[model samples]
Target: MNLFDRLLLFILSVVALVLGVAVVLVGAAVPIGWAQMELTRHPYNIVTMVVGGVTALIAIRFLFFRRRRDPKLDSVMVAGDHGPIRIAYDTIVQLANRRGSQLKGVASFETVVRQGQGGLVLTLHMRVLPDIDVAALAKEAQNAVKSYLEETTHVPVERVLVQVTELGDNNRSMRVWSGTGA
Candidate 1:
């Protein structure tokens, strides 16, 4: 057991001892004296005293006994007794990479996984095609990643942040949708 538990047990034992002595003195000695006063020598003297002492001893013994706390095998223990928190971090990043690359205006997206105070945070540094709505694309990608992560694991996504890393203008020359802007 730990030092705190041991200290608690010691305190309980001392309390029990004090109460036991008080029980013996009050129940056995005083009552025995009263019996001698009522009867000739002692009417119900010895029996009452023995019973009281025995009962007190038994109660004291029960009081000092304690229950053990559940311990862990690992040296690193955090958030005790909540539940299982075995989250595969790599899997969440992979989901982010895939989602970021799928944006219509995205050129390429790179990700950096950071461990924060709360949990793992995925930071996506995305290279987007120029003239595309970068802000909207970043928001969409963040939402997608958040949804996917919450669905996948228990560690929780503290932050799904996107950084615009670079720009590519190749898609502007495709001329496929020119009828609308003309």
Candidate 2:
């Protein structure tokens, strides 16, 4: 949460606690030296005090509570012959890039790997050369990356998603402008 939100919550909790304690004291027939009233004489005063005290306690507890976050999983563990082996995500990305760069019509690419239940999921964001079939390029990239990662890392690939981001002019021939209206 943001600082402003935290500050607001803290202020509200303090207010709730003060009001709750005053209500409870008054319900128990104890005089609240500041405010003089007959709230304790009511038949439902006990119920009101109970609700108020619970609300205040809850607010107090929440004021000190913090949410827990899970640590990031950056490496995958594989059982080796001697012991367990850890494969870093950077290594997988490098392997994926190697495989993708080898494909024709692929100008540049970026790969992301996510650990899944069955296996690893690879997503490739690519910039391909102009005048090429995007569908074919995507299919080729998916197959190449999936097979390459599986063979090299010995990890099963559940899915390979290919996103053709842009058309690159890296393979185009250079042209010179004549400045005139030629």
Candidate 3:
């Protein structure tokens, strides 16, 4: 649950606990001054009952129906000769990035790794240098990333999807020469 929900639940729980204790004390006929004066009165008793009932219901709903966050998969397990080996997804993605970035045409890139039934699926989103062949670069990137991850992690790579998102020489300076330029 979120912070606000948790805080509201806590407040409701405290109120419910206090109300329960007061009810028990009143039922047991312990002569508390506030209980005798306030609780025994007409409007105060009704308002207290309504507020207590609503608080109890809200607390129950919060406890039972709170939103659950999906668990993030940090690592994948691979079978080995001795037993099993755990490889972190971050390591796999880093390897893919290393191989992809090493290619000549690649300027910069971001990668994502998804766990598939047979193995891992890698997706690369990249920016390439101007005048580079985007289609060739994308194909090369897919093969490079797939082979590198499979070899390094010893895990099957189901697919590698590459997208050439941008084409630019980010390090190059551009000069706009007007007709009256120096």
TM-score of each: 0.45, 0.57, 0.59
Q: Write the per-residue lDDT of candidate 3 for residues 59-158, one digit (tens) a residue.
A: 5565565555443466788889999888888888788888988887677878898888888888898988876678988998988888877778899999
Among all candidates shown, the one with the greatest TM-score: 3
Each model's C-alpha lDDT?
0.65, 0.81, 0.74
lDDT score for candidate 2 against the true structure: 0.81
Clashing pairs in 3: none
Cα lDDT of model 2 by residue, 43-146, tens digit: 46658779888978977886786756332377788789999888988899999998898787777889999988898999999988776789998999999899
Off by over 4 Å in 3: 1-72, 170-182
Candidates sorted by TM-score, descending order?
3, 2, 1
Index of the highest-lDDT prediction: 2
Return the candidate ranking by lDDT, descending: 2, 3, 1
For model 2, the run of ten residues with the poorest summed lDDT = 171-180
lDDT of 1: 0.65
Task: Give, for candidate 3, the lowest lDDT window spanning 10 residues.
Answer: 172-181
lDDT (0-100) at residue 36 of candidate 3? 62
Query: Model 2: residues >4 Å from true position, as ranges?
Result: 1-72, 171-182
Quote the lDDT for 108 in model 1: 73
Name model 1 segments beyond 4 Å from true: 1-87, 169-182
lDDT, candidate 3, at 140? 88
Would you give me the overall lDDT of model 3?
0.74
